[model samples]
Target: MSQMTSQTHAIAPEDADRAVIYGFVGRLLQAPPSAGDMDVLRALTADETEMGLALKSLSEAAQSANVNSLKDEYNALFIGLGRGELVPYGSFYLTGFLNEKPLAELRADMGVLGIARADTVKEPEDHIAALLQCMEGLITGAFGEPATLPIQEKFFTCHIASWAPHFFKDLTAQNTSAFYAAVGALGGVLVALETEAFGMAG
Candidate 1:
């Protein structure tokens, strides 16, 4: 990751573009291996932007790991017997239930933005992947409109800010985490960055 400086400047919403990139990087940080993992990893590692480059470095470092290992790590973190050691679901984090207040709230917000949970997902819409996908959707204009800074902040604060940092902290300290430790580091840093950046906006 490029060293972020403490230079002072105008607080225009455009100044938040870096945070958007960081948010995308945070998504990539926690992404498990997919069919195109190599290609995606290469793209991110070779990316010119700071977040992309950071992701790329982590990706490269994690290259020796096979997809099955990544899957096992993911399962250990998120899908243990009946429940994982660290539940990555917003509803569970917020309401202490699998699909409760937090999920309802996120569903309402997603509906307003025209995002629906995938039919294939058995989990609630508050899964970390789902929320990260929402962020991606906002960035890519998937909800028929681009998300304004305030919109992004609201979504992030309401959903991600509530618990993701703690989750990543757990991931970082997990006994089974190895390559994912890098992911946890990236996530922890981004959460701190986002928390401070959003505070600046407020």
Candidate 2:
């Protein structure tokens, strides 16, 4: 996981909320949730909003989740013997292959934005979790000063908007999914909400 720097600038409440959700989903996708993580999920509250309902479902899923079972599910769904049920990389989603142009493009953008993959991380930089965490950092000034809305919109449009929604849709549809289905549902809603909000900003 990326170790983001301390926040230097104050983020707007809405942007802070966005950062929290992005961070939450990014962390969840990176690995199976630990018992403590499950406890956090189970404590989540919900309202009638679409995002809230997704949260409610996730909370329910977490309440019933077994740690060992979740580990198996995570392995089956994301990391299998040869390959998992899904390839959670942006390049594969965009190009039907890994280490393609999409990843190169993302790396180039990362250079420009002062984002760098940690030396400890073995996975490619284009993993969905990495990209989402990058966005969270941008929103919260973890990379530097918080990125402006236009900057955020540009990154989202170029990197996430094109493929993440479809990826989440696929995740939700997977037979191997149990706790992850709720994750996918929440991810879908978040991407949709971000897309719409960015559109309005544009």
Candidate 3:
């Protein structure tokens, strides 16, 4: 239930789309989708693109799914004993380990960005969910900055583009992923869209 803030200009259509992507992905990773969330998604409409089709599928699945079922699936896919079907960590995805140099590097850059861990957060800074939250803040100036697209692009290219898409691909392919498979599809498509959009920038 975090509110993204923006100043200095109108919220572009694309920026809103980015927020939706980041927010949904962050929420999906942070917790299981509630019955209320499923209801909200079911009312959403999708256009005729690959990403839109994926979203349409997500909406359909959410409509048919209940909170308890999703909660159990979430536990299996992300919170199983010892480990889950997917680690969902940049350090794990990039280096085959947790708390590795990628995390160190992200921390150093976060320092530059004036980012800090909340006292309530016990998770690592390099967790994919946390990183996506950071991206949402960057794009929306939720952390009290200019919300420069270039800065957002740099942060994404450095911290996220390296492994998140592959992680999504893996998530999509995992047997335990029912609701999350649609999440993976949307995440992968959004990341690719961001990558291409950034590449088009001068």
Off by over 4 Å in 2: none
From the highest TM-score down, the ranking of the candidates is: 2, 3, 1
In candidate 3, what are the lDDT values of residues 1-202, reduced to their tens digit?
A: 2333445345678887787688778888888977778888889798988778888988887876778988888888888998988898899999999999999999898888877887778878887788888887777667676468888888899889999989989988887756788888888888898899899993
Model 3: lDDT to the true structure: 0.83
Stretches of model 1 off by over 4 angstroms after superposition: 1-31, 38-57
Q: Which is the better candidate, 2 or 3, if ranked by TM-score?
A: 2
- The whole-model lDDT of each prediction reads 0.67, 0.92, 0.83
Kindly list the per-residue Cα lDDT of model 2 for residues 70-136, writing each as its tens digit: 9999999888999999999999999999999999999999999988888799999888999899999
Clashes of each: 1, 0, 0
Best by TM-score: 2
Residue-pair clashes, model 2: 0
Worst 10 residues of 1 by lDDT: 1-10
Superposed on all Cα atoms, the candidates' RMSDs to the truth, in angstroms, are: 7.7, 0.9, 2.2
Q: lDDT-based ranking, best first? A: 2, 3, 1
**TM-score between candidate 3 and the true structure:** 0.92
In order of appearance, the predictions have TM-scores of: 0.75, 0.98, 0.92
Error of 1 at 110 (Å): 1.5
The reply for model 3, stretches above 4 Å from the true place, is: 1-9
